[model samples]
Target: MEIRAIDHIELFVEDAEEPAAHLRDGFGFALAGRGGAGTGLRGCESVLLRQGGITLLLTAATSADHRAAEYVRQHGDGVGVIGLLVDDAQAAFAEAVERGAVPVAPPETVGPDGARVVFASVEGFGDVEHRFVSRENRAGPFAPFIEETGCGRGGGGLLKTVDHFAICVPAGTLDATVHHYREVFGLSQTFEERIVVGGQAMDSKVVQSASERFTLTVIEPDTSRDPGQIDAFLAAHDGAGVQHVAFLTDDITTAVRTGGERGVRFLSTPESYYDMLTPRLGQVGVPVDELRELNILADRDHAGVMLQIFTESRHPRGTLFYELIDRRGARTFGSNNIQALYEAVARQQAARPAGLD
Candidate 1:
């Protein structure tokens, strides 16, 4: 499959309003389009929000029989569809299906203003789907099936595009998941890491497309170690699902500040991590104290250095959250930062009062 960048991501929620408002009123996203009963979409209501190169489709079920409702009931409010931009949707779907991917939806073509687009879907992790999208004649934010609503962006511009995704699977399913991406989408497993955070251990492997436009960090917990965040996620989410979506930003300092000022809660990095930075890696792109103040973690590879920080999951079940990443000529996702993130999450889990929302 000749994959380009991520076209969009569809999140199934109990109601489209709250998440849509969060992305709009808190994060800077403009309501681009919509589809519902009036738009000829039955049993579901969808709101498309856009910010820079990121398009998020928030869909809610209007009826009990809708798939979105069933997904929400099983996995809670989470990602169900990951749309990939490809040169040919039909070819991509056919190739994937032929390569052991279970077919979800066959290629369906739709055009508006004489421009054509073809959409197809295949099975992904658990109940999530991999939607192949091809804009043969022209490219647009959404398909022609949806009408533009002209809902303007509220206030967010600090963040830009999706950086990568951290996918948490069951302890034994990590290898199988990585193999599936390799066999179906032609993504290659690039790097691997085993991190032990506060006595809990997890192994991670990264898979990237040929163009490096799409990346999936597949992680699984070590059952012999302490039951930690990944375990907590599986218990709450009911199955494998997207753990966190990392949004790429040009200025992570500004992005972190904007998010913090807007009531977005992020994990805290210990001062010791910053104190040892100069001795370990020497001076990097961003100052150590500044990063520590913002609770942003830094790491470097042969390519370059990068800055990143994660927000605490706001979902009631603690299953979904976001990360802000700024890569400065850095092709590799921060390895040290992953350890830091694990510790950060561990601290959060320890401090959360039981029975609290």
Candidate 2:
């Protein structure tokens, strides 16, 4: 079984239209399609938005008995499905189930215009499900069953495909979670780090697909210690959930500027952090001043450099946020940038009270 890039992510929200609009207006995503009650979708409605190589399906369940409704009621608008692009959806599902992964759905076909798409799902951490999807109708942003609205793909913004996902699991489940990916998906642990900032501490393990097209960094807070952002996330989320989705951008500078102009607020780094960057990275891609101006973080490895910036929590519960990243040949997830992110989050935590501001 071979998993390619992230196929698409389905976010189950209380109301699909509102969140879908936020992404379209604020993040430059274009409405690709929609499906709802009248469209034979039963109790749920989904809004498909696409930009670059990223596609987001904002879904909301109308009935309380629906899985999406329960997910939203507990976690407050979070990722429910991570559609994994696979060579064979049926085979991937069988392999995953054989590896002890809980089966969510067996392979099924849904098509329009004589074009078929096969899909199956396996349970990921918490309520999140991994969908194995392959389509004979891969030309469009999505399958023909979604009822294309003709908004087309993306708003032609700098934001490209998804870079990685940051998943926050329960403290004691970190190792087990890492093992699940390895055992089921045949991914490997590329990097691991334990970081402490102020009273918060977390252990992170990065796992990725063979081609490095897919990456997931699982983080779990120190349960014995004081609650940090990760703790707040698990508590507020009511269980483990996706913390953030990092979207790739070809030009991060323009992306951040555009996001800000669209009224999207980003997390900031201290100016002092910039002064220390040069020594570690040793002549990075973006200049220090430019990085400082946008509060973007820059990090480098032996091969090349990367620039990244994160958005402030857009969800009411502070459980959902996004990161914009540009990789100019830097293979690893930014090690230095991760430390900087920890401190940045610490500062934000200090400024806000218990609940999301």
Clash pairs (backbone) in predicted model 1: 28-156
RMSD of each: 2.2, 2.0
- For 1-357, candidate 2 gives per-residue lDDT tens digits of 788878899999999988888898889998888888766687898898888778899889988898899999888998999999887899999999998999999999777654678899999888999999987756553764478878655457677898899999988999999999999989999989887776778899999998777889999999777788788788878889899999988899999999899888899888789889888677776788988999998877766888889888868777788999898988767766766787777676677766564
lDDT of predicted model 1: 0.85
Q: What's the lDDT for residue 296 in model 1?
A: 86
Q: Score residue 299 of candidate 1 by CA lDDT.
A: 81
Instruction: For candidate 1, write residues 239-316 as lDDT tens digits.
Output: 898999999999989878877787778999878889888888877778778988899888888988888889988787
Error of 1 at 147 (Å): 2.3
Question: Model 1: which ten-residue window has the lowest total lDDT?
Answer: 136-145
User: Can you tell me which runs of candidate 1 are displaced by over 4 Å?
Assistant: 150-156
Candidate 2 weakest lDDT stretch, 10 residues: 136-145
Candidate 2 differs from the real structure by a C-alpha RMSD in angstroms, to one decimal, of 2.0
**In angstroms, how far off is 220's CA in candidate 1?**
0.9
Question: How much lDDT does each candidate structure score?
Answer: 0.85, 0.85
